[model samples]
Target: MLNGHEEQEGVNKFEEKDGNSKNYDESDATVDRHRKILHTDNLKLQDEYQRLQQQNNKLQLLLAEYFQRKKCESRFSDECTDEEKERCYHNTLAKLKELQEECVDQKAHFEDQLKKLQEERQKTEDMVETELEIFVVYKREILLQTMKRHGGKRVSLEDLDRLQQVEERREKELARVQLENIKLNMRFSKYQEKFKAHSIGVDGQHLIDYEELKMENHTYNEKIEEQKEALQKVKKKISSTTHTLTQVKEKLEFIKAENLVKRGSLMKLEAHVNEKKEALKNLKQSRDSLWLDVKCLRCKSGLLRNVDLLQDFEDHCDSNDALKEKLDYLKMRYVQLTQNCREFRRKVQYAKQT
Candidate 1:
């Protein structure tokens, strides 16, 4: 009986030890599974940290490149003359300050946008967590009811596998969001580069237009100066013409006064010539009367001499000779005066022709 009891005790102890060993093995497996999950979490964190560090390194390289380019451009600035350099420096400083202000504004706007995006993300996460919690609670109640109906039967393994697939799908959606964020950042960078290039092109075009406008303005100013000179010359010529006209008018007045004086002299000479012509006519009439008287007296004396009238006849003859001489002299003087009047008239007419 003791041996049987002792053997039975040994069997029980072995079975118990076997049970303990199985429990220990299961515990070890559970611990190993937990350790694997922890290692996965640690690896994920390490990868994220490495990615962040790489991003930082890329940003630093970009900044260094920008600074180097700026440094290289500084040498060209030294080539400008002092006056131009001073003006350019002031303008550049003003422009740089304006660009800095714009950048600051853009940064503030982007930060605000980021804050809004984060808030939206947080809301989405909360909603997802709430939905998950509700689903878990509902599933637990369904499981309990199913167990009650099936005398504690478990859910199907296929259903559990489907749930795991849904979880993976959610993880894929999160990864898609991350990829979209990366694409957006790249697009933003490309846009910035294009904008900078466009601004440079616009600035160059503006400078060219300004230079053309300046040249046009200078040309117009030259034309105005030429026109002003031409106007001044025209004014001088006009003044000279006006002065000449005044002189001509004065000369015309003098010519008119001289003509009046000459006209008065011509009238006096005409009056003298008319008086001499009248005296000549009177002398010729008197001569004709004397000839008639002498002829009549001779006839009478011839008759008387036959009857003793000889003395009277002699006296008459003497008187007739004296009268003849005086008549001749008067006729000569009249002819000379007539010739003088004709010569004077001829000279007056000639003077008018010249």
Candidate 2:
């Protein structure tokens, strides 16, 4: 019977050794798997770091280009013609487009990385859960042993202190992350508001330009009508001049007939008296003075017509100058309005961020 008990004891010892070997094998395998995962995480982190470095380099380059453009624009602002200004705006628009595309790409990349990281975190958590379960069972056994030895005492003081420290650390990390998120949200809101105000200002400026153009068109139509009226007045003046010329010709013909008859009479009277000859010469001189008066009237009428035309031209020039001044004022106002809108937008964005 003693040998039988000894043999049973030996069998029990061997079974215990087998159980320990199985536990050690599982523990080693789990540890190896965790190590492999950690190595993979390290490699991924390195790759991400390199990508971030590249992005930073690109950002720096973009900033440098922006500064260069600004400098160039500042130097040229006073001298820039309409076409040059347009070219500068076009270049800026193109750059904005490129930036938008880059932002989209970066957003996509970040989302993808986030997804990958979440998946890895989930897997890691699962592994941790399994390990924790094993540890919990081991700890339960140890706790039971400790309770038995110490008459139901609780956990060690050191362990409690460590747990409190861990909790505090986690709380701090969460708070930090939340604060960062709040800041980002605020900034995003600010930017959005700024963009809205800018857009509204642009719309308002466009409306003003449209109104100005309509007014300009109306003024041009009025000018055209005035020009037509002036042309009609000129035509009327020409017709009156033609009629006067015809009357002058008729008067000249009549004077010639009268002179011929008078001369014949004078020839008959010449045999009677020299006094009658002096009276005939005086009448011829009066006829010559009357012709000079007619010529002077025609010259005076031509000078009046020229003066009227010149006055009309001066009036048109004055109107043009007034229109140009109004246009310049409108343009200046539009620019100011746009600037104000931009500032409003920036403020709104800042408010939203806050």
User: Pick by lDDT: which candidate is best?
Assistant: 2
Error of 1 at 253 (Å): 99
- Which stretches of candidate 1 lie above 4 Å from their native place? 1-80, 143-152, 155-354
RMSD of each: 60.8, 66.0
**Whole-model lDDT values for every prediction:** 0.55, 0.60
lDDT of 2 by residue, 258-300 (tens): 5456556555665556787888899999999999998889788
Model 2, position 16: C-alpha lDDT score: 55
How well does candidate 2 score on lDDT at residue 232?
A: 60
Give the per-residue lDDT of model 1 (tens digit) for 56-90: 44544455556566568777667768898679669
